[model samples]
Target: MTRLQRLVRIAWVFCKYRLDIFLPMAELPAPLKLFFLFAPWHLFPKGSLDRGDRLRLALEELGPVFVKFGQILSTRRDLLPDDMAESLRRLQDNVPPFASATARQIIEDSLGRPVTELFAEFSRDPLASASVAQVHAATMPNGRKVVVKVIRPGIDRVIRQDLALMFMMARLLERYWSEGRRLHPVEVVEDYQTTIYDELDLQREAANASQLRRNFNNSPLIYIPAIDWDHTTKRVLVMERISGIPIADIESLRAAGVDLKVLAEKGVEIFFTQVFRDSFFHADMHPGNIFVDASNPADPRYIAIDFGIVGTLAPDDLSYLARNLLAFFRRDYRQVAELHIQSGWVPPETRVNEFEAAIRTVCEPIFERPLKDISFGHFLLRLFQTARRFNMEVQPQLVLLQKTLLNVEGLGRQLYPELDLWSTAQPYLENWMRKRIGPSGLLRTLQTRLPSWLEQSPEMPQLVHDTLVQLRNAGAPDRGDRQAAITAELAQRHADRRWRLTLGALSLAALAWLGAEEKLVPLAQNMPHYGWALLALAGWLVLKPGRK
Candidate 1:
């Protein structure tokens, strides 16, 4: 459809579902308000469904791209309201399969061989169909079972069209919505655009599978299918096919005698291993992409598929995240709050006591229940919410990680209701910490870098001599220059202190203004003015330089 026609269709869907509740009427532009007003859907009365349901249904009715969008949004409980997030979680990417003829034609074109030559037998029927791709079961001439994944025909054009509209909507929301700037609608859409486009490339997916398979070469916790590179192409992926019960099929898993408790714990182990151990994880671990290998029912392993999306963290980010998780497990609220500032996740000037209290209030209640009863996903949501209150900036890299954690935790709890994820994860993270930050870790680092240090050792003496000569020319280390350097360092420290005080003053001024404007009503009502004044006074004690 033309872009104009697409806009009209979207408008119809919006009005049909009464999704106008999402828009802040006063914030909308005049022309846009007029356009929606002229739309034809107002004649019919609105349905009895709640606002969240209306939003979910409208996205579902919009087609594959929007269904996937809703699913992505559902993962972001931190960004959306509770009702909306819950409703969006119900969005499913259950698109119908495209024509087998088209799939066959695309395969032949990508591999430069007919389906017959590529595989001894190829099923015309699709094994599964998702928004971006469909899989067909096949067998090679050597009788190796494999599955061929083909990108939907002409999907790129459709995605491009939809993405253009998506960008426009994101811009509007970010411009007009009160929470738009905080929610970062445009960035979210950009992330989705990158992800959906990445999924369109079969070769990338094949590489991801290969890397993950190599990461867990022979481990039994989780299984990633091996890629058949010989027949793989940009638009076509061929991988070893294995039969297993879907992870969501709990009844089938139970009937097959798979040990549910062991299976669930193994799933958690695999998740932590992928994240902390390997620093590479399958971001999309939804039930549809996961399965249980019931061949050994006593020790069931997870079979992972659809490696189109994955997450990796920077070394620093990974370290901080590990520390934060460990602190949370220990119920060290002060340390958790401190870590947020130290990691730059929260503003440096934030009050540790207040932040710690906020965390404790949100999290302490969470630990009151049994491990199986606690929702780690919801815990993360609350943590993110509290961080938002402190003006903590969102880490885009961790978004996928948070989503995968939710999936893994949800699946874990589903498989075994009494699963203590904390028990399973706490020790794993602690062990990782020992290996990562302990004396052994230091020795391991030295061992790995010793050879490189030795390789450059031949120049060390000359380098040292040259440094001494330069220092000698500039006067000895014990001379006036050294005292001058110390004096300069002292001056710099004083300057730094001065700047910090200046920043604190500005922050206090801002806080005073906010208080005077009656924005502190709830806070003042909760605490006397003197204590509230003290709290506002400490606002300037923020560690980081004041933000403009």
Candidate 2:
């Protein structure tokens, strides 16, 4: 459908669902307020269903893109209240499945073979379905169990249509909204576009799965299914079929004698390990993408699937984030505020004392509640609300991490009510911080960076010579300096030799310090003094009168 028609359809859905009440009339522009007053949607009665249900139904009526958007927003528990998030979470795996025959046709065409020839047995019915794809059970030619996933026919066109509308809306919001610059609506849409397009390509999903499997190949914390590359393609995927109890099925897990507490803690550990140690993590960890392998009821391991989205952190973001969380865990609001300004995520001119007070106002009251009663979701909700006062913009790169973390927190709370989230995560953050600062971290840093420093060292003398030449040329008189230049040239020749020697000494000092910092120099002493002496000598050579 064209974007205009899609927009009309969206407006219809919004009207039918009576979504106008969700709008903030007080904050809206006069034009918008007037438009809403005359909007045809006002003809309908106010919805009896609550706000959350109204939103959920509106998204469901809109189509797959809206459904998937709701699914993502559902995981962001921190952004929504409990009832709203719960209502939207139903969109996670409830996307209607496409016809089995159509899926079969896609598989056949993608693999260039008949289903019977490729699999020992293939099931027509889908075992699971999602916005972009659906999966069916099969037995491979090697007699191994597998799942066949086929992309929804023509989903790309549908996504692109919706994405175009999203971009339009985002641009309008960025242009017209009061807080547009701070919120960065267009950039958020851009990141969402990149993420959704990546999901459209099954090969990228396969690679993501393989890398995650390698990240936790043998560890018992989680199990990732193996892919069958021989049968995988851009439109189809065949992978090892795994079976486990649905993570949300608490009663079944209890019946199976699983230790819920241990299971919950392991989930937390697995998430931290992926983020800090592996630096790679499954971004979509809602219960729909996670299952509990409770074969060992005493120590249940998680079975993860659906690697369409993943996240990684830059080394600096990772460090600053971990420190920020650690500070929060310790109730050190000042440290949290300092880390924000220090990381350049928050504005430099922001007063740290004021920011700290704002954070404390938001967080200190939560301490009154028992550990089990405190919600990470609520904490984040308030913290972000406070962040707006300081003009802190959204970090697009952390969007997936934030969503995945909310999912993890929700799952942990579901699995075990008394789970102490702060205690569970604090050590991981502390350990991660230590690893980036301690002796081993320093050694690792040198090993990775020393070569580049050495490679650039030889260019220093030439750089100095060029700078001196530029200074001499810039300092030259327009016409009269030439008479004195002949005499100065003779002196300059002598000065140049000393200047070159000093430059050489300075270069040596750089190399020596690099080695000394890495501790290659045994009992290294006065390395800074040596650098100062070299710098001092270079200054004297440059500043001394040139025999004129």
Candidate 3:
């Protein structure tokens, strides 16, 4: 169907669902408010429905792109009120599955092979279905069980039409809204475009899964199923079939004798490890995509599915982020405020003290409660609200990370109420911070480059000789005041080189000191009450205390 036809169909669905009744007519725009007085729009159902429900219904009615947009928006609890966020969170892609025959045809066309030849058993019945894709259980010739995921037939057309309409709306919003600059509606739409397009490509999702699997290979915390590459295609993915109780099915997990506390603590540890160690995280970690492998009830491992949406932070972002979290943990609101400005997450002109006060107002109360009791999602929301006061535009990417983190945090807490997230995460972040800013990191860098430097050592003398020859040939004798000038220049160069070498060596020693700190402490303890004399002897050589 055409785009306009689709939009009209959407409007009809909204009306048929009696969505208008849920909205407050008086609070809407003047155009919509006036429309409420007319025929079909005026025939509103009388009930207890709310604005949040109305918004959710309207987006769902608008079809997949709109529904997905709502899903993305639902993650930005920082932007939405509690009720609205709660309502939108229910917008799951539970639409009817496309025909199994059609899915087989798609796989055949994309991979140029018949289904019978590829799999020992290909079930027509869908294992699970969603708007974009559906899966079917199958087995390979080698007797390896796998699940084949196929893209829904004709979805590209549907998605394209809806995305075009979304872009149009975003453009209109940018043109009309007074807060357009701050909102950056066009940029938001652009980001959504990139994300949706990435989702459209199953290969990208497969690669993401592969990378995540590699990151946690043989780890006991999380399990990402292996991708069956030989049977996989662009439109069809064949992956290891996973069996676990759904995370949402709390009763099943409880009945299976799972240790909720250990499970919850593991969840927290996994998140920190992904963020700090891997730097790549699964951004779409909703309960539906999470499952619990309770085979080992004492130590439950999480099974993660749906790799279509993931997020990674730049190194600089990760560094700044570590500091940001540490600052928040320390209750140094001013430093947090300054960091935001320095990192350019917030505009530079924002007053540090004022921002600090605003942040303190938002965060100080949360500290009154235990860290587990404090909702990371809610805290982020309040922080964004405070940021909005200072005209700080939101980072669309960070919103996804924040949303996924909140889901993980919420799920963990629900499983184990006693889980102290702060306590579990604090040490991880602290260790990461120390490595990033301390001596061990410097030593690692030096060690990584040392082999290459050794390989190039033979070329250094020749390089120096060539440099001196070029300088001399340029005009050594003809230059006026040449000798004296060259002498002065050499003195300056020598001083500069001396300082550079000093700083470099100091950094190396600092890293070594950090590495040896624990070992050195014991050695110092055993130093026969004369450690001061040893230090004095070493200091005299390095510092030349006799030289003024």
Candidate 4:
């Protein structure tokens, strides 16, 4: 459809759903408010559907891309009202599969082989279909079972067209809506564009699955199916077929005697492990992509699929995130606020005391509830809202992490309503922090860099001599007296370099020792600043004034 036609249809859907009633008419200009009065949809009687349902219906009617957008929005419980968020959560990506004949043709054309030649048996009917792709049951010649994932034909064209409409709408919202600039509608759309386009590449998805499998190799907590690389391609992926009950199938899981509480706790552990331990996590961890292996009912494991979208955090982000969560668990609002500023998540100029107070106000009441009664998703939402007052910019890289956390939390609660997320996660965070910042961690870092240090060791003496000479002669004039001054300056610089290096090494060693004792938690918390201090000191000593 043409962009103009699509826009008209969207407007019609809005009016038909009586969405105007949900808007704050008092806040809108009189002229625009009057436009709603004359809107043709007003001629029809108001339906029984609520605003949330209406919104979901409108998106579903728009197309697969719109439906997918709603699915994403559903995860942002912090941004939307409870009713709307709940309603959108039900937006499923159950689009009808494309023609089987067309699918077969594409497979043949892409692989340059007939379906029968590639597989011992290929199912014509799709086992499942989503907006971007569909999975079909197939078997290899060796009698091993697998699934063929095919990207929807011409999906890129459709996505680009819808994305153009989305961008146009986002621009309109930014221009006309008061909250648009704060929300950053354009950036959000661009992020979604990048994510959805990434999902179009099956090869990327295969790599994600392989890496995850390796991360959890032989582990009992989670199982990632093996990718059949020989048969995989950019447009198609073949992976070991895994059979298990859907994670949402509570009845089936219970029937199999799976421990719901343990299962729920494991979900949280898996998420933390993926985010903090491996730094690579499945971003699209909705129930549809998750399954429960009940072979051992006492210790159920997660079987994950559809790794098209994944997330990774930088080292600083990972460290700060772990510390923040640990602080939150301890109800250390002050530490949490400090971490935010230290990590540059909020502006450096933000007042730690005031931010801490605000966080306390928002979090204290939530703590009154029992662990099982609290929702991490809502807590994060409240935290985000509070951070906004300090002009905290959204971290786009962390969006997927946030979304995956919501999914994990939701799925955990669904499995066992009484799950103590805090208790389950606190120890994990504490352990991760210790391993990351403790003496052992320092030793590990040193071990990893030892080779490089040794490789450059031979040049160190020359480097030191050259640095001293440069510092001594930096502003010395070419004269007889200057020659003696330069020599004296060189000797002084050499002495200063030794002392500076000694002090720096001692400071780091002391820090590591204190970290081992857990006495340097506060120091570790402020490690970023200490790092900069060390760097500045090293630079100053290397260029400090000498006898000259």
lDDT of each: 0.84, 0.81, 0.78, 0.84
Question: Which RMSD values do the candidates have, in order?
Answer: 16.0, 6.8, 8.1, 7.3
Residues 1-548 of candidate 1 have per-residue lDDT tens digits of 88889888998898889777777777788988897786576765688999889999999899899999888888887688889998998887888999999999999999898888878999989999989999999999999999999999888988998999999989989898877887788999999999999999999999999999999999888888889899999999999998899999999999999999999999899999999988999999999989988999999999999999999999899999989998998899888999999999888899999999999999988888887678888889988988899887767889999999999999988999898888899899989989897645654565465445434533444454455546555766555566655554555455545544654554455456557656557655775675555444444344645222
Q: State the lDDT at 158 in candidate 3.
A: 84
Summing lDDT over every window of 10 consecutive residues in candidate 3, give the lowest-scoring window.
Answer: 539-548
Give all TM-scores, in the order shown. Answer: 0.82, 0.84, 0.81, 0.83
Residues 204-237 of candidate 4: C-alpha lDDT, one tens digit per residue = 9999999999999999899999999988888989
Error in Å for residue 54 of model 2 = 1.8
lDDT of 4 at 83: 90
Deviation from native of the Cα of residue 247 in model 1, angstroms:
1.2
Q: What's model 1's TM-score?
A: 0.82
Clashes of each: 2, 0, 2, 0
Q: Candidate 4: which stretches are off by over 4 Å?
A: 20-48, 450-548
Clash pairs, model 4 backbone: none
Candidate 2 structure quality by residue, lDDT tens digits, 86-205: 799776446788988898889989989888799899887789887889999999878899998899999999998998888887787676667676777688668778878888889999
Least accurate 10 contiguous residues by lDDT in model 4: 450-459
Give the range of the ten consecutive residues with the poorest summed lDDT in model 2: 450-459
